[model samples]
Target: DQLSKQQSEGDSVIKKLKEELAGEKQRTHQLEDDKMNIIKELTVQKEKLTHSEQALSDLQLTKQKLEDKVEDLVDQLSKSEKNNFDIQKENHELREHIRQNEEELSTVRSELTQSQTQGSSRNVKDDLLKERETQVQNLKQNLSEVEQLNEHLEQVAFDLRTENEELLEAYEEVRNQLEESVAGNKQISLEKTAMLEWEKAPLETELCRAEKRVLEEERKYEQTVQELSSACSPDTSALQLEQERLIQLNQEKDFEIAELKKSIEQMDTDHKRTKETLSSSLEEQKQLTQLINEKEICIVKLKEKSSELQKELDKCAQTLRKNETLRQTIEEKDRSLGSMKEENNHLQEELERLREQQSRVVPAPEPRTLDSTTELESELSQLHRIKGHLEEEIKHHQKMIEDQNQSKLQLLQSLQEQKKELDEFKYQHEQMSISHTRLFLEKDEEIKNL
Candidate 1:
């Protein structure tokens, strides 16, 4: 009976050992299933991390492009500000020029007012008219005097000419008389020479005969003296009578020589008187000619004075015409100045509009990064529903990426439109400034011409 009891206990122990082995096998299978699920979850996390990294890289590139666009816009804004400053400077210069023109216009208006006031006064006008009338009358009187003087000088010259002709005739007559007297004196001298020759021959013959007679008388007187000494008295009275006849003949010849000397002295006095009369007539003709020359010079000076007065009258007329033109130009300038003020107001409004537009432009936002710890916690909690949750998350991430891309594109379009508007505004502003400068230059040229 003890042997049978030991066999039963061995059987029970073997059965218990088999049951424990089966339990161990089932626990090993459960552990292996858990290990596989954890590995799959880990792989899904790695794929999500790679997608997120790609999205981050795309966001970085988009941010860099946005920063470059912002820098470009900033540079454009600075350039526009510089352009505005230059335009303002030009506008200031234009205003200064306008102010100077206005000052000039004011002065001109004052002068015009003074002239109008003077025109209204009857006393001033009458005085001016009287002065002009007096000047005209004086010029007329001067002209008449010059004409009368010229006539008087002509009459005097005529009388002098007539007197000169008469003197010339008298001189010719004296010259002819002198020539005739000289011819007569020459004939008389020739006749006297022939007569002297004839008288000399007879006197020499008579003298020779007288000397022979005297010699014969002397011999006869000696004979008579001898005869008287021998016998005296009767022939002495006859010799005395012969001596008295010879003395009477010598006295008659002396009377004829005295009469010839008196005729020669009378001829010399007549020739000297004729010469003095001819010289006095020539001196009178020279004096008359000098007087005529002085009268002609006085007439020429009077004519020159009349011409100078005429030139002064012409200058006064030209000045009056210039004053009329100046008044018309001042009126036109006032109208132009009014129009320029209106244009200046319009430009200031446009500048204000541009400043407001520049202030309205929007800026870019900051970028974000992935949070790894939060993603790991979320993955663990959704482990059983991982596939479904991953599908929904991927769709949501794609929608967010699409929305970000759309927003970036819209910003680019807006920037492009604003850049186009700015360029067009700059072109219009430049054209307006050019036209304003051209108008100002034209006004300046007109003023200079005036």
Candidate 2:
């Protein structure tokens, strides 16, 4: 009964151990599955990390390109602004020049009007002088006709006086003879002599009046001639003074015209130069606008690349977290496996002590020896079965451990690949930064020159 109780107790302990081993095997299988999952997650994380690094590199390259483009745009914009300022200055100068030219033109028009007025006045004066000369010639001809008429009148008067004297001598000789006959016809002869004397007296009075009027007219005409001659003598001097004045005015007008022409020519040259400069400035502005557009495109592309890199980085972080959890589960499984191994070693030591005590207490009788042998045989058979079960459980745990190890190795390899990719991306980013800085410096120098 005691042996039977010991056997039953050992069988119960073996059953408990088997149950524990089964539970530990299940745990180890779960751990192995977790480890495999972890390795897969780690692999996914490494791939994601590699992709993120590539994306980061692309983002950095895009950023650098955008920076360079921005710098170029800034330089172009600055140059365009300077050109605009210069054009504005030129426009202001042109406006000033135009205003001055308009003023000069107005002054020239006024001078021309004055010159035309002076010329018209001089022509009118010349016409008046010509009419006066014609009047003087007509008056001289009338004075000569009056002198001829006075000469004829004086000759007639002399002839009439001689005839009258002869008649008077005849009358004296005939006077004595006439005394004898006078008594008969004296009244009739006296009447005839009275009639003749009356006619002669009236004629003589008319001639004296005509001569007096002619002398008065001659004196008045002579005075008028002397005054006209004096007036005519100064006309030449007056005309010369007028001509000198006109010549001086013409010279002044010519100088002013020359100066105005010179100014106009200079203004035209300046205007042409300004137009050319404005055209060049417009071309530069167009180029600057084009550069700005290109910069904007580069910036958009850079932003897109940055977003993609961030997404990849996020996915890699998620996968890394999953890998960490899996690694912890694998560690727990390994600890459980070690504990089970220690329990198995303790059970083996207890079995060995029990076997040594049984060997020392052997009986000398046949019946007793036979009973002891049979009990020992049964105990040995049970021990062998428990050992076989323990060995099978250990083999299963060992297989799980090997699988975990392989999973761990795969995870490490993936991690190494990800790290190498990250290093490459970092190196590329540093190089880009250096190049971008150099380009920025050059752009700054260009701006200073501008």
Candidate 3:
């Protein structure tokens, strides 16, 4: 009956473990799906990031070209200003020359008039008239030169006006291009943010659902464990002690699992924050180094946790092997108990035959029969005592086997749990490294561009 009860309990435990395994598998599948979805989103983000970077490069090139154009226009404007100054100076010199010639011509005319009024000799009058005529001819030449200078200056002024108009048009076009580029950059930023938000929403919901499911499973498992502990008999105090320790370990493992989940969530948040910072304006990009440092710290922590989980897995494996050996030992002990029971049955049958033979015997052998019966009774009592001791030992061994099995199961469960956590940690670590590399490259490129 004890064996039957033990088998039933083992079956119940196995069923529970199987149920937990199925649940773990389901959660693993869910995690895989979430991972795939996240990967898809990351891929999309990468494409968009590439596109944005390309667009940014193009915009930067455009801005550079426009800047160069503006600088050239400024140089041209400075040169035009200098040329205007030189032209003005030349015009001033020309005006002064014309004025001096006019004064000379007027003086010459006065002298000629004075000579004519004084009635000087005809030679003197002729000479003065000739000089005045010469002066007038020189004046006419100067006037003609001045008129040509004026026409040249007017042409230069017209050319300057036309060039200024062209420069203004170019400047306006450049300004319009700049405005369009700024608007386009703003639009791209908005689209990027919206896309990120859209992607983040679904992941958050899935994480929430997964957490809820895990919590529900944990509660059920705890309730079942409590029921089993309460149902256990006082004779199994050792088993109970073992169970309590297993429960504590399980609780610790659960806590660790919860911590891992929180860490995963934190990692997601960090990733999102980093991405947002990347998508922010150029000024905010300067903080990327610090963020990368923080991410590195997170990676280090994750590595530590992974190492711890690995150690735990190793320990569980060792314990599982030990439990396997214990199970074999228990089975051997059970066989010994079975053989001893068979011997006891044979002894009981021999005693029964001896009794029947005595009943069939005559009065001539009564004394010998009485002595044989007494000896047989003593031997039977001794056998019964041996059988009782063997039964107790078997019961003790069975309990040990049950405890070993329970521990084995717990170890297996912990192994599975640790394996899952390790996988997730490794995956997240790879993702972080990938993102870090990409971000580092991006920052380098941005710095180079700057």
Question: Across residues 1-450, which tens digit of lDDT does each residue of candidate 3 receive?
Answer: 764585376457647755665765576577667657755655555565566556545544654554455455445435534544554455455456545644654564456346434523233434533543454354345334534543443453344345434534543453454345445545544565576567557656755665675566557556755655565565467556646755674575467457647746765665566455556543333343444455456445545644554454455345445544644554464465457546545544554554566568656655654554455345435534643453454345334434433443443444345345434534543453455456546634432322
Prediction 3 TM-score vs. true = 0.44
Could you tell me how far off, in angstroms, the CA of residue 394 lies in candidate 3 after the best superposition?
Answer: 99
lDDT per residue for candidate 2 within 1-450, as digits (tens), equals 644453354346435544544654464465456436534543543344344345545555654553454344335434434443443454345346434544543454344345333423223323323432342343234323323432332343233233323323432333333233222222222332343245335434543443353345335434533443354454556434534643464354345445534544543454444345334434544543454455446435544543443444344344334434544544464454446445444544543544455467644443543444345335434433543443354344334333433433343343344335334434644653454344334323322322
Question: Candidate 1 has what TM-score?
Answer: 0.26
lDDT of 1 by residue, 18-98 (tens): 353354345335434643553454344334434433543443354344345545654543553444344345434534643
Give the runs in model 3 whose Cα sits over 4 Å from its true position.
1-13, 16-19, 22-216, 219-256, 271-450
Give the runs in model 1 whose Cα sits over 4 Å from its true position.
Answer: 1-113, 118-123, 220-450
Candidate 3, which ten residues in sequence have the lowest lDDT sum? 119-128
Task: Identify the superior model by lDDT, candidate 1 or candidate 2.
Answer: 2
Give the range of the ten consecutive residues with the poorest summed lDDT in model 2: 180-189
Best by TM-score: 3
The root-mean-square deviation over C-alpha atoms between each candidate and the true structure, in angstroms, is: 79.8, 81.5, 67.8
Local accuracy by lDDT, each model:
0.38, 0.41, 0.50
Clashes of each: 0, 0, 0
